[model samples]
Target: MKSRFTPLLAGLVLAVSSLTVQADEVQVAVAANFTAPMQKIAAEFEKDTGHKALLVFGATGKLYAQIKNGAPFQVFLAADDKTPAKLETEGDTVSGSRFTYAIGTLVLWSAKPGFVDDQGEVLKKGAFKHLAIANPKTAPYGAAAVATLTQLGLLDAIQPKLVTGENISQAYQFVVTENAELGFIALSQVMADGQMTGGSAWVVPSNLHDPIRQDAAILAKGRNQPAARALVEYLKGDKAAAIIKSYGYAL
Candidate 1:
């Protein structure tokens, strides 16, 4: 009886040990524009892989600065592909670990219904007292907004009316709170399930600005972290792609 019980006990111990080894947590620095989708993806990732993602959100540039200063983040999801590539070139990321996770869309949005037209003629109309935009120096979407304005030859005209936010989230907040009549922001922020979540918006044309190719990478700090690698792989899977698309981003 003792011999038979010994083998069974050992098997149970081994199984528990395997479970413990498989479960892990990773710290991730994510772009503010990706908040909603990343939250959903993180939840799904934990349920499917038993790996937890601890997310910290901010503007891509600020996150990059933090990472440079040794923030201990294992994975980085940036608002533009350029930053991750720069990290790779700077030897701050794992080689061949960077990938484009989502293609973001910029939108001019207003919290009030019918306030913005589909053609985005409002910028030329210049009817609003305050037009909110993220800081172009730190946020990719804000740079895109500036580019679009430049292409439309309205940057000079709209310069004085501009209200700048530190990041895209804060820019959206300005519009939502009516501090600005409308703001340039990510399409994901105002979209859900293939429909506008609220108010009105003008989806900026791709030709108006450079493509917003958002990318992800495993940082040097996460080089040997299993959870970090798992999260990156998970982001490439079908489930994560669907979640990303549902938030108004492209593959």
Candidate 2:
């Protein structure tokens, strides 16, 4: 009887192991500024870790609202540290699970070649008909853009020309589509291999605004999830860091 039971137990253990090895999908809410890098990280994560990350991109504030209202996302990659910290405080996230994954940089970019000056003198010149920026109320990058303008004492003057987008990705589109002459956007949106891929841009100085310390956290719904934890760890790994750095984000 003992010998027969031992074989049955071994078979059960093997079946459970096989189930664990099979990839599990984790739903992730990602900030728009991290779009390109997140896409790359998700592909690599699935390939190397046998876990699938189903990513949804949007403004951090909007994503936070969704989470508060019980969105089924297991992981959140925010564009700023504040939103994750807030979620942790609100008991919406797994405690002690939040960490800064990347430091984002902002840029003023335009579709027209040589339209934006490196020194950002174009803002003062104000020749363009429209200047696009993300909605500061919802997008951290947009808040940073506003902060930069305030620091330079140009907020009031630039307000008349302002065209706001719901998120940084849309703000970038406004400029790239030439709907707005120029726009404040994430450097990663228009950069490749640490250089501007097209048109001209002014890489905004870090001192101009608060550091965009992007953070990632596991949500309450994901507290018991192995696949969610795996994604959080994968984001801190060397491969993910390299992909993020290549997109102009600092690890």
Q: All candidates' lDDT scores?
A: 0.96, 0.94
lDDT of 2: 0.94
Give model 2's clash tally.
Answer: 0
lDDT of 1 by residue, 31-94 (tens): 9999999999999999999999999999999999999999999999999999999999999999
What is the C-alpha lDDT profile of model 2 across 62-167, one tens digit per residue?
A: 9999998889999999999999998999899999899999999999999999999999999999898999999999999999999999999999999999999999
Clashing pairs in 1: none
The parts of candidate 1 lying over 4 Å away from their true place are 1-10
Poorest 10 consecutive residues by lDDT, candidate 2:
190-199
> What residue runs in model 2 are displaced by over 4 Å at the alpha carbon?
1-21
Q: In model 1, how large is the Cα lDDT of residue 102?
A: 97
Top-lDDT candidate index: 1
- Per-candidate total of colliding backbone pairs: 0, 0
C-alpha lDDT of candidate 1 relative to the true structure = 0.96
Name the weakest run of 10 consecutive residues (lDDT summed) in model 1: 188-197
